[model samples]
Target: MRETLAKWRPAIDEAIADLIPREIDVDYLESFFGEATYEYDPDGLQRALSDPIWELLDRGGKRWRAVLFLVFIDAFGEDPAAYLPYACIPEILHNGTIIVDDVEDEAAMRRGEPALHHLYGEDVALNAGNAMYFLPLKILTRDPANLPADRRLAAYEMLMDELNRTHLGQGMDICWHNERDVRVTPEQYLEMCACKTGCLGRIVARLAAIITDQPAEVEEAVARYAELTAVAFQIGDDILDVENSLGRAGEFGKEFGNDIREGKKTLLVIHAIEKSDPERARRLQEILQADTNTDEEVLEALSIIEDTGGLACARERALDLAAEARAEIDGLDFDPGTVDKLHEFTEFVIDRDA
Candidate 1:
């Protein structure tokens, strides 16, 4: 993972820096927000978000999936600026999703600080997330001259579609928390990942292809391929959440380990329940259902996960998805170097420490 990132990092960094014009690029994002404001103070909103949301973005880990779109656009001879507005859309949307997710999960910490809702109260935090969510698409609709009317319309449509899929997936995830008694099959878990993570990632990939005006068939194929890659990414996240404590600390540069405590029906946890001895499974089920459980109880549940083999199965399945994505992308006309870079990006997702 380190090697793959070291190779791609410089390229992505340079590309992102040049995505917007030099003059405005050097100006602060808040300044732009200031310019576009409705003459009212967002004081409360600012206080709630100024730290957690921006810090979350700035304390960046690997931003591979977003970079994939920017670089893919570069591949087709378009300037990276051609897609600059949308470049950060995926990240913003992802962060907004996390904000809502933390409140829904009643999560306590975010990047070593209190989760937004925990710090600012749920209603305020949700409003903060809504504000953040609006910026990405608003930016996407910027520069009408850069994006043609048809392309602009297409971008909005895809953006809304991506958000809808993610919201639906999150609803399923939240519902699973309350319905822990139900069995979740491996196939079902994969579908869940597709809705949650895969959909947005694939949206960006397909959008990248769309900017090139690639044939409909080709764009669909690339999106389908990217969809699988996204699933692998989310599966890897489930593994990290159960197997590692990084999310709590913010030290590993990646959030970790809430899925189990929150009873997310990730493939890893589901498989463990499906595979455990009846007695052990019962113990885990108790932990899952324990809303009043202390951190110690959560730790005990972690112990159960350690003894079960479900986490390893999740890792294996993620790798399989990556392989499938690579095979599908190989069918496209992407340049050899681009294909290699993309493959590196895919493999790195599961292998990554963050």
Candidate 2:
């Protein structure tokens, strides 16, 4: 699986580099900023937009979303190279969201470097982030993959729906964080995970199926598999936050206990609140609600979460979801080898440290 992914990663990167505009055209600048601004250094404007976009892309991520897309393409017996451009669209969208998320979360680092917003200021980061959000539409409509018009339209619609769902999930997270009195249930947390993390996986599966003319049932099954994987992936991430803070801080390119400081309502936190004694629960809430928490306070909260069995519950749930995801692949008509790879990838999703 690692060898296969290694071979595909460069192709995915090339596709992204080709699709994302390297230089902003003069006419686009004129239209965007009006003639007065166009009279200014267009090169400067172009650099302002293109620099941050490339910086973030080049910063390097695991490119898991694109890898999943190619894996699905292979599973469906298609030429994965032919669909490389399509595979890259989700990754670009994912990176764009990361930039925006960092700004919103006040994160200082990403991929082990200063967050784009921190380097270029929020204004430039916001502009580049929004550009990434809409830029893939250009690639889709242009039919770089030479998909049929109907298929292109279908992919476009699916991408739009996925973006909408992701935003809605982010909105819920933001709202929950702001409303100090609000308590999130496990079901609600899973729903949010489906929207925020699962949507991209679902989009890739459904779009690949659409492009390849798969039946609706196959598309639905593939999407379900991806969604389940996403749920497990998110739970794994929450668990990592605690683990990384305790032993592997800075290894994952994110701050240790940052989630705790931000008062994120992760699944473990939710479970801990529900399972803890009243006094412990109250203390947990107090720590989470604070605008800032000391490292010692964060450690205390982590200890409470562990003692109350929240960590164990979260780990079990993640493993269960991963198992469910693999089982869904069994119901599909993919080749046995492909199914094996998919199962392996699902395990990797939960087991990955970063």
Candidate 3:
């Protein structure tokens, strides 16, 4: 899986660069946005947009979502390289989300460095992040792939629906984290993950199916696989946060117990709260509800999760979901190599330490 990702990184990075250049200039602006209604300020734009956007991009990310799109294209019997511009959509939007998420979460670090909002003021970061949500829409408007009108329309509608769903998921998460009294059931957590995490992966799968003109049944099947994989990946992420805080895993980027600091209602916290003794459960709730916590408090929270088997339970659930994700495509007509890659993709999402 790592080898496949490494092999594709250069192409994915190049596609990203083509969409958002190293430097913003008049020519790029004219090409992307039609002739300016008034004079444009290249310098101001560069400072506010290009510099900070690339600052986050240059800090590495797995770019797995983009790869997932391409792999789905291949699975659907199409030339993945032909859709490179479209592939950039999910990757760029993902970075945008994380930048905004950092600000909202009051995150101290991202990708092992200060959050974008910290380096650039909140206004600049917010605008830049918001711009990313629209920047990639240029691909759709330009019709660079010369896609059929219906296919293009499908893509547009998919983006709108999925992006809106993402906000809904984010809203649920924020409301839970900010309030201590909201008890998030495991089922509710999975639903939130499906909306927040699964939506992007659905974009990848559905976009591929749309471009390739796959049958409706096939599209649904492939999308289900992608969504399940994404949810499992999110669970793995929650586990890694706890593991890194416990010194059970190496750096996964972000701070240790940052989730605890944010008072995130992660699956681990949910399980631990439900399974612990009443006194311990109340203590856990009090710790999470507090405005601030010491390192010792964070460690205490992690210990409670570990001792109550929250970590183990979450891990088991993640693995089960991964297995179910693999099963989603078991009867598909993909070639042998694509099947292996798909299986590996499912495994990578859940098993990855980072």
Candidate 4:
């Protein structure tokens, strides 16, 4: 796996290196928020608000989404310059949402520092999220010196639709917080992840390809690639929540075993619930509902999940979907070099620890 990633590193690095804007338009991002931020005496609302946006930018994640966008666009024969704004639109929006989500989840830290909301207050945290939310639109409109009016309008329309869907997804996530009907089938949960997590990322990747003037058929194919890989990414996240022990740590803003506590319909939980003996299930339900499901109790549940086929099924499903994505990439009209880098990214998604 390391060798494969190493081999593809150059193209992937080139693709990522190309995404950093030569000169960005920061003013336009804040323009939609209106210049007048409410007067604040203490707590440093302005500085706190500014911190998350820059932290989000410099955090330097995998940069996979941007890389995917650039490759898909290039495959479709579009210049990187034309598609970059669209790529940044969703990335910024995603980061913005994460800022708010950490607050909602009460996450203590982001990128090894106290969460924005934890340091600042919820009010400032929310504003920071809103500001990051419009970054792409600002980037698009602020610098028309380079683009024609029609193309700029097209970019805004596409970005708006994606942002709207992302909001719906986030709403669903919050609603799931106290949901009792944890009986959603694997397929149903996949649908949730699709809309909430995978939907925008996949759609915009292809949207970037289309903006580059690639045929509609090619764009659709690339979107499929994004869709398949997204499930793997989501599953990886589920695994991390269980493995990343909040108890041993000094702080974790989000609740440890939050998925179990919130009755999140994860594959492990769902399958464990389904397969446990009836008496065990009844006890499990009681334990789940009670306020006293201790760490030891959650560990028992984890053991049950592992003993049953739930964990195996999830791992198999994630890999199967990733394989499907790999096949789609092969069928696309992209260069072998680009396709190889994409495979590395796919592996990265399934294998991510955090």
Q: Which residues of candidate 1, in runs, are more than 4 Å off? A: 1-39, 42-53, 241-259, 292-308
lDDT of 2 by residue, 105-216 (tens): 7888888899999899999998889877877667676676687788888888788888899988888888898988538899999999999888978987887788887888
Off by over 4 Å in 2: 21-42, 246-256
Please give, for residues 196-272, the per-residue lDDT of candidate 3 as tens digits: 88988888888888888898888888889988998998999999888878883344233778888778888999999
Clashes of each: 2, 0, 0, 4
Candidate 1, residues 208-276: lDDT per residue as tens digits?
Answer: 876667777777777877788888888887777765752353343233345555666667567777878
- Runs in model 3 with CA error above 4 Å? 247-256
What digit string (tens of lDDT, one per residue) describes model 4 on residues 1-354? 345434444554342223322222344223434454753322343365545466555655555565567666666666654555555655666677788888887777787677878766788788878776764556566543366676567566666665676667667766755565555567766777776777667755755754565566776677778877887788867766665643333453445666666556676667777888876665555556665567666656656666667766777877887898899889876777778878876786545653
CA lDDT for candidate 4: 0.64
Clashes of 4: 4
Residue pairs clashing in model 2 are none
lDDT of each: 0.68, 0.83, 0.87, 0.64
Q: Each candidate's TM vs. the true structure? A: 0.78, 0.90, 0.94, 0.78
Candidate 4, residue 275: how far the Cα is off, in Å:
2.7
Better of 2 and 4 by lDDT: 2
Q: Candidates sorted by TM-score, descending order?
A: 3, 2, 1, 4
